[model samples]
Target: MRSLTEQDIRSSFVNCSKGEAKRLAIPRDLDERPWADLDFLGWRDPGAPDRSYLVTERAGRLVGIALRFPSSQRGFLHRSMCSLCLTTHPGNGVSLMTARKAGAAGREGNSVGIYMCTDLACPLYIRGKKVPEAGGRFEETLTTEQQLARMTDNLSAFLDKLHA
Candidate 1:
């Protein structure tokens, strides 16, 4: 997998809204599939066990991934980890995600799926990003770069398994 910058990722998303590509949380499965055609790229947010996230990937690299966890409860699903950040949320934060094979991914099976942070805040994690956990803002310990690297490493492993 190749290393990437913020722009390299946001540019591939046709659905970018404001600066949401960084905070809105998109999916890692890049190729487009009709909603009904998609098998594992999305999951019901545990909080709102009915809503799902939108997962996608960046162009020009196998490293960048995103997810859009829905905030509304209107569906059903199982528990899973977000392929990008590797942070597991309860049923509320976890969601199902997947993508199709094409381009360099054609032989990689028709699709790949993963669970993700329902809010899709991986950008912060990718670009030296992080938010204070719970009420521990002033006592936060992990550095931004540390957070980014951990996320990158975890995401890479997740995608690699999919390739295998």
Candidate 2:
């Protein structure tokens, strides 16, 4: 992924009002992000832990979406797999992050969700830069590139549901 500017992110939102996008929190440490290793930029709002954001390039344009999850629904009893990266996380490490659909459907309260890394660090986990507390990645015959492609496909499918 390429490094993105604040303006780029604010303008990329597809599911929220322009004013809401303008007011939403943008990460402060943009320069510190591992852009080359990232498939998308995602972060939870510091002030509102239940609210999160994600931005990525799709079909030659940047697409951004706001997401939310039940903060109180922590998974402390068992391990769960992140649908995007296939990494298993124990406890509150995975969440059902949901995004409002784009256009009138979203206005009608339609939304889509997927089980994802709680920290929104699927790329890092897949690349071995971050490790889940439950265990390391499961041994797989696929290479890193294949893994990344799989993750991207998973995300694209979720995005497709939002448009559907």
Candidate 3:
């Protein structure tokens, strides 16, 4: 992953209106992000808790999508696995993030959802930069690079669904 500018992020959005993308929050601490450790940049909107965003370089281009999760705490009390990285976390560490599909499908209210790390820190969890309360990552025969490849595959599939 490469460090992204605010303009880069705002212009990368594919699923939302240009005006909405302009108004969406980009992280204030972009300079401090661990860019080398990221497969995608994800963040929840501080002013709108249920809203979130994800941006990544896919197919040789930057693609971004706005996401939303249920605001109520209905599903945050138990351990869950992030579908993208397969990292498990206890309590509110995982969330069901959904993104509206791009183009007319989005206008028709079509969307897709997946269980993901609430903080959008899948790479961190996989690389031991962050630990899950579920007592860390499960022991696996795969190397870090393999794990990263798996995560990227999962993310690409998700992005494909949006563009489908």
Candidate 4:
């Protein structure tokens, strides 16, 4: 959970061409992002509503993914837990965040979705964000390791679900 730049996010993409990444229509207000408060960043492509982006730090380097739309949810998204940075959100937040599966997978049009926190605030959810609830999850339990585990588990589950 460190601060990231628009460039950093742009460069982390593994599935898209450098030119495509650079040319991607990024949000103009990059400077106004709550960098210090974000655990990771997620956004949808302006031109392609079906395309999306997510950035996170794994091991020490930054990693990003270009995700495609899920099968198609009519008003409601599927209910699954994110294994990466566990912190469940309403189905509204969970979406099929399949990377435009690269290589042959991409050729085969394979994609995977991630059930993620709607707000994408695993860090805040774990460390506690400015929720108004009096005795919510954060107030009752402030365990860091547990939070990390949930995050990891949520992401793992997401990966597993993609193949299932």
Candidate 5:
């Protein structure tokens, strides 16, 4: 992923109105993001914990989506997995993030949801830069490259649904 500016992110949104995009919070650490390690940029709004955002370069263009999720903390004993990166976490570490569909469907309140990292840090988790305290265990035989490809594919599919 490449570093994106506030303007770039605001303009990349496909599911929200221009005015809404302009008003939503953009990450304050854009310049400090590790772009080389990212497949997409995602963050929850500090002002509104239930609100989140994701942006990525797809099919030669930047695409972004606004998301919503439960703000309440989860029980510590349960485990959940991120649909994109497949990293398992204590229940509190995952949330059901939902994105409104692009265009008309979104305007009508239709949305799609999936379990994802609560902090939207799938890239770091997958790259081993951030480790879960519980330690993730994968029984699959795929190599790291294959796992990464799968993650990309899953995200693409999610984006496709948003665009559908």
Candidate 6:
């Protein structure tokens, strides 16, 4: 992934109005992000707890989506897996995030949802750069590269659905 500027992010949004994207919070540490290690940029809105965002390069252009989810905490004892990176976490660490579809469908109130890491750190989790509190343990034959590719593919598929 390439490092993105605030303007780049604001303009990349596909699921929200330009005005809304302009008003949403952009991460302050854009320059400090681990771009080389990222498949997409994901972050929760600091000012709006129920809102989140994701940005990724699709084809030759950047595409972004705005997501909404409940702020309530889930019980820590239950285990759940992130649909993106396949990392297991305590139930509280995952959430159902929904993104309004792009264009006309979005204006008509259509949206898509998926279970993802609450913190949206799938890239780091798969690379072993970050570990969840529940400690995901997987006995898999796939290498890190393979896992990362799968994550990217999964995310792209989700983005495609939003466009569809």
In order of listing, the candidates' clash counts read: 27, 0, 0, 17, 0, 0
Write down the lDDT that model 1 would get.
Answer: 0.43
Better of 2 and 5 by TM-score: 2
Error of 3 at 40 (Å): 1.0
lDDT of 5 by residue, 52-160 (tens): 9999899899999999998788778989988988888886788898999998999899999988888888888878888875848465788767777888898899989
TM-score of candidate 1 against the unseen true structure: 0.39
Stretches > 4 Å off in candidate 3 = 74-77
* Per-residue error (Å), model 3, residue 52: 1.1
List of clashing residue pairs for candidate 2:
none
Report the lDDT of model 5 for residue 90. Answer: 89
Tens-digit lDDT track of model 3 for 1-164: 99999999999999999999999988999999999999899999999999989999987899999999877664545688899988887776778999999999999999999999888989988988998775357899999999999999999999999989
Q: For model 4, where is the 10-residue window of minimal lDDT?
A: 131-140
Candidate 5 residues lying further than 4 Å off, grouped into runs, are 135-140
For candidate 5, the C-alpha RMSD (Å) to the true structure equals 1.3
**Could you tell me every candidate's TM-score relative to the true structure?**
0.39, 0.96, 0.95, 0.66, 0.95, 0.97
Per-residue lDDT for 1-164 in model 4, tens only?
A: 56666788789876666787888766677676666655566677778867767776666777676676644543433344444554444444555555655456655767665555444455555655534122124233636766666665565455344334
Predict model 4's lDDT versus the native.
Answer: 0.59
Tens-digit lDDT track for model 1 on 1-164? 22233455555432223354455433343443232322123333354433444333424332333333334453234334456555544445545555443234534335555665665556543332445132112223667556556665665555565445
Each candidate's root-mean-square deviation in Å?
11.4, 1.0, 1.3, 4.7, 1.3, 0.9
Q: What is candidate 5's CA lDDT for residue 151?
A: 84
